[model samples]
Target: MEKNIQTKYWVVDGKEPDPGIIRQAGEIIRNGGLVAFPTETVYGLGASALDDNAVEGIFRAKGRPQDNPLIVHVADMDRVWELVSGVPARAAGLMEKFWPGPLTVILRDGGVAAKKVTAGLDTLALRMPDHPVALALIRAAGVPVAAPSANLSGRPSPTTAEHVRNDLSGRLDAILDGGPAGLGVESTVVDLSGETPVLLRPGGITPGQIESVTGRILLDPSLEPGAVIPGKPRSPGMKYRHYAPAAPLVLVEGTPSRVTGIVRQMLEENLLRGKRVGVLCREENAGLYPGAAVVGAGAGGEPGETASKLYAALRRLDQLGVDLILAEGVEPRGVGLAVANRLRRAAGKIINTGQLHE
Candidate 1:
């Protein structure tokens, strides 16, 4: 846990990762060392899933809570069978439809992975990342990799290797740079450890897409807007305040005009109070905020665009050293639901104009 740990940094091609560099990074994981690697969604700090000491190192390096479980990434279905007790019919179907993508499924533990990977829980979360670097590293490591967001816990997830180095340079064994992550959010997590599939957390995958596979899935009550997880979270980003930047953030939700108007008003008020205010909005509204620092998540306020740019925008505002941030929320449907969920958690306060007419 010393601050002087020597970290290796390597750059790999996103399309065709260099096998030599991947092998070196894989060896680190095989030897119970931590490595931060890129996935389609975000960069993940990984360790050998079967190594207890290595898994413990991840929590220590990131200062993450031990109770918060980590997602185990596998290169193939064979590894999936090695980690989970069984894959239900629905879970198997989901894997068929969404594997090699940003979807994490929770299943019963098979007692094969490190105890810490499951956080003493009877269930384990597993994913097959779509990124080439991720799969190459996992395959080379020869073990399921237990990983979480590469950045320090509670911070905006890293979308670029530079972001990872900023937060975890001295704390990790190695960092495999694969350029910027595509989705810029975590995987969609669905829990199938029970009779029905439960949406634990929304992410790159839409609920409608999942529903198309499994008839009707239930949403975790904790995911309800304004609802707090009272106890240990069943998934990452559920229990704690995560994706927060250094400055306090306020989320504004309503019609697009209403959200923009309210954020502008707040921006002026904060500026008048001698505060360095930052506005996080769609590219179309970027010109609306004149004096305040403005960062756009995406153009046209599209959910997919917003989701892919949200974390990076938050990190950029942090670098600007703003005293406060006002973020415009997207609609709670499709990938927009995931975008709004992250914004709500990041915001210290939220303003929802109950007017449903968009």
Candidate 2:
């Protein structure tokens, strides 16, 4: 993989992407090569969805599992149906409202996607990203692009172009540097192959919003702590533990005050043991941990801010060389639920503030 490394790195103005540069990345995808480009959510490792060999390169580049599946990004509804058997009525409504945004829908297989893209299942996940560079590449390639987060399989998902470089610099044919992603998290993945739509993953689009558009949607049981996901997962974030950082992490969940107390106690205890600890908390809670390296999750009480800063905060803590990270969990409501989900998976352990500290 190292021998064929290209010097083709390109940067877009974010306002007006260079058509020529985007076409270059598109050609790579068209010819079965990998390109990492920024999306509104996170940077994505993209390949032509219709090309079996190209899509396989995406799994290999990210060290992603074949059975885990990948989301196909398109430029429009026509491209969407070209890859799926047909979009369900509910899915069509979602696409109408959320296409060109951060939502991925899984529909019945049309057999147009590579077998490996769907993990040989009868369904494939699809989305149309709202990022300029991403859309440009997809349109230039003139084929649906299948992408996973542009990071190593289990590591923190890359939200900036630098993060992608840090993880996949030499592996891809080119990387479109379009500044930091807007969402800083992955898309909401909803499975629509069944009678009632099931939310396979909580993301930028909340369950409440989906319910409003498609009526009541079911939540996969595996989304809860200690519940096993039944059968093969039809969505990307369902199959594995992900968004982990290098240092061991523990999630602290409770009311703001209780969370602060728990984090304060843990930081002190770990500091007494001479462990260099990092606290990922909100701006107001920074003063609680006097001796630990503190990385802010968000400002005010806005979970959108926290969701945007979550991965970057984890990466910053890692850069500070902390031995352990103790994070204050966001409330399990709205986009906050998705933020909490990523934090819990990133953490090897979870501590409810009401529980006694070990």
Best by TM-score: 1
What ranges in model 1 sit over 4 Å off? none
Return the lDDT, model 1, position 230: 74
Task: Estimate TM-scores for all models.
Answer: 0.98, 0.96
lDDT computed for candidate 1: 0.91
What is candidate 1's lDDT per residue for 1-358, written digit by digit as tens? 6778799999999989999999999999999999999999999999999999999999999899989999999999998888888989999999999999999999999999999998888999999999999999999999999999999889999999999999998999999999999988899999999998999999989999998998899999878767878767778889888899999999888888788889889888888899999999889889999888999988754789988899999999999999999998788888888888898888899998765237
For candidate 2, write residues 1-358 as lDDT tens digits.
Answer: 4535763678887768999898888898999898889999999999989889888887777888778888999998898767777877889999889888999998898998888899978998989999888898999998899999999899999998899888887778888999999888899999899998998889999999999999998988768754556667788877588999899999888767788888888999999999999999988878888999999988746889999999999889989999999998788788987997888778788887663222
**Candidate 2 global Cα RMSD:** 2.3
Model 1 pairs in collision:
none
The C-alpha lDDT values of all candidates are: 0.91, 0.86
